[model samples]
Target chain A: AQSVAQPEDQVNVAEGNPLTVKCTYSVSGNPYLFWYVQYPNRGLQFLLKYITGDNLVKGSYGFEAEFNKSQTSFHLKKPSALVSDSALYFCAVRVGGFQKLVFGTGTRLLVSP
Target chain B: SQTIHQWPATLVQPVGSPLSLECTVEGTSNPNLYWYRQAAGRGLQLLFYSVGIGQISSEVPQNLSASRPQDRQFILSSKKLLLSDSGFYLCAWSVRGVAGGQETQYFGPGTRLLVL
Candidate 1:
């Protein structure tokens, strides 16, 4: 079965500092990876997805992720973090020819001002 | 522009009570709809998905059931709710890709269910 793992439970960073949220996935075939953000008591918002393209995929809110096939990782990254960027982040993977997406346990991002 | 809506925003019911959560999508036709439960604000567990009207596929066997009577309307219900059913329920929709690739799923605002 396809699965995604987000190792960090929470990550704390200072405002304006670079931030990275790690994500690794396991799938039988080529993986369709995605990143989503969620605020308190709100549904998840799509950030970006990696189907087949360049190694790096840019997304909304100045966030981006890199798909490293060799490493089987798709890590969300931002050059500079903001206090508003603090939220829960999730990584999901969809195996080829599958409709269901396997999601990882979310990582809480805490940005200090 | 496409959008998804779910209601009621919050619900409180007894453990043995019934449950009915409704979700509808606008500005899109023949879109795939899904029902997911998020427990303790963590990873999401897909409960059901529908490729078209009257075609419901259940991913988990639990106290909940889903029905798609209309093209864009999906409903989740249960005859008797359980304490474990208390969580955030989300409805999502995605367009089917031509090449059979996976598409991005757009989620609704979600409904908070609390069972006493």
Candidate 2:
């Protein structure tokens, strides 16, 4: 079964500092990876996705992710974090041609002011 | 300019009570709809999905069921809600890719169900 793993439960970073949220996925074939953010009591908003051809994918809010096929990782990153960037981040994966997405447990990003 | 809406925003009901959470999409047609449940500190679990009207697919065998009577309307129903069903329920929709590739899903505001 295809699955995603977000190792960190929470990550704390100061404002304007670089931040990284780690994610790894396991799938039978080529993986379709995605990153989503959810504010408190809100539904998730799509940040980025990696389907093919690109190792590094940039998303909304100046966030980006690198897809490493060898390590089975798709880690979300931002050069400079903001206080407003604090939220719940989720990594998801889908196997080839599958519509259902397998999501990670999620990582809470806490950007201190 | 597609949008998905789910209601009521929050629901409080006793265990064994019935549940009816409605989700509808505007400005889109023949989109794939999905129902997901998110437990505290956990990832979203896919409960059901529908590709078209009257076409429902169950991803997991659970106490809940889903229906798609209209092309853009999806409903999640449970005859007897359990205490375990207390969680955030989300409705999502995605446009089907013409080339059979994966499409990004857009989520609704979600309904927080508290089964006491």
Candidate 3:
């Protein structure tokens, strides 16, 4: 079985400040990781994914995530925060060759102007 | 290009009432379809998936059931609605990728269900 963990329930940041949403995963063999964002009453939008090659993966909306195999972590990072960026973010993982994804509990991001 | 759509953006029903939610995909053929539920303030839970027409895989055992009657259509149904079933239902589709590769899942706008 595969699983994902997001340690933070909510993260607060000021506009123009850097932000980080933490994620970790446990799975057998290689892992395929993904990041998604959801606004209130809206469907989730894909941010990025990590399959292989280049530990640093760049995603939409000026966000990026670094995959650390040693720690089994894929942390989402942004150079600066925007009020519009405040939303719920989820991290998910799947084992190689599996089509199903196991998602984290989700972290709500709040950016104060 | 591909698009997924779910009908009845919001539904309110009494307990013990029948439930039905429809989802359809356009511009894609033989796509893998999935049904997921998200409770308030929680992550998504995979309820069912279909690899092809008439082939449904259930992840959780509940009153809710899913059927893929057409290549591009999937349906979620319940014989009797339960309060526990109240949640935001999402439909998604993905291309079947090769071994060791990852496929991106595209989601629908979702249907919010409330059981009274």
- Fnat for every candidate: 0.67, 0.62, 0.62
- iRMSD per model? 1.3, 1.6, 1.4
Could you tell me the TM-score of chain B in model 1?
0.97
Q: Model 1 segments beyond 4 Å from truth?
A: none
lDDT of 2 by residue, B1-116 (tens): 99999999999999999999999999988998999999994689999999898999999898999999999999999999999999999999998754444689999999999999
TM accuracy, model 3? 0.98
lDDT of each: 0.95, 0.93, 0.93
Return whichever of 1 and 3 wins on lDDT: 1
Give one digit per residue, the lDDT tens place, for model 2 in A13-109: 9999999999999988889999999999999999999989879999999999999999999999999999999999999998867457889999999
The estimated TM-scores of all candidates read 0.98, 0.97, 0.98
* Rank list by lDDT: 1, 3, 2
Q: Candidate 1, after superposition: displacement of residue B58 in Å?
A: 0.6
Q: How many angstroms is the interface RMSD of candidate 3?
A: 1.4
lDDT, residue A1, model 2: 86
The DockQ figures for the candidates are: 0.74, 0.69, 0.70
- Identify the leading candidate in terms of DockQ: 1
Better of 2 and 3 by DockQ: 3
Q: After superposition, how far is residue A1 of candidate 2 from its true place, in Å?
A: 1.8
- Ranking under DockQ, best-scoring first? 1, 3, 2
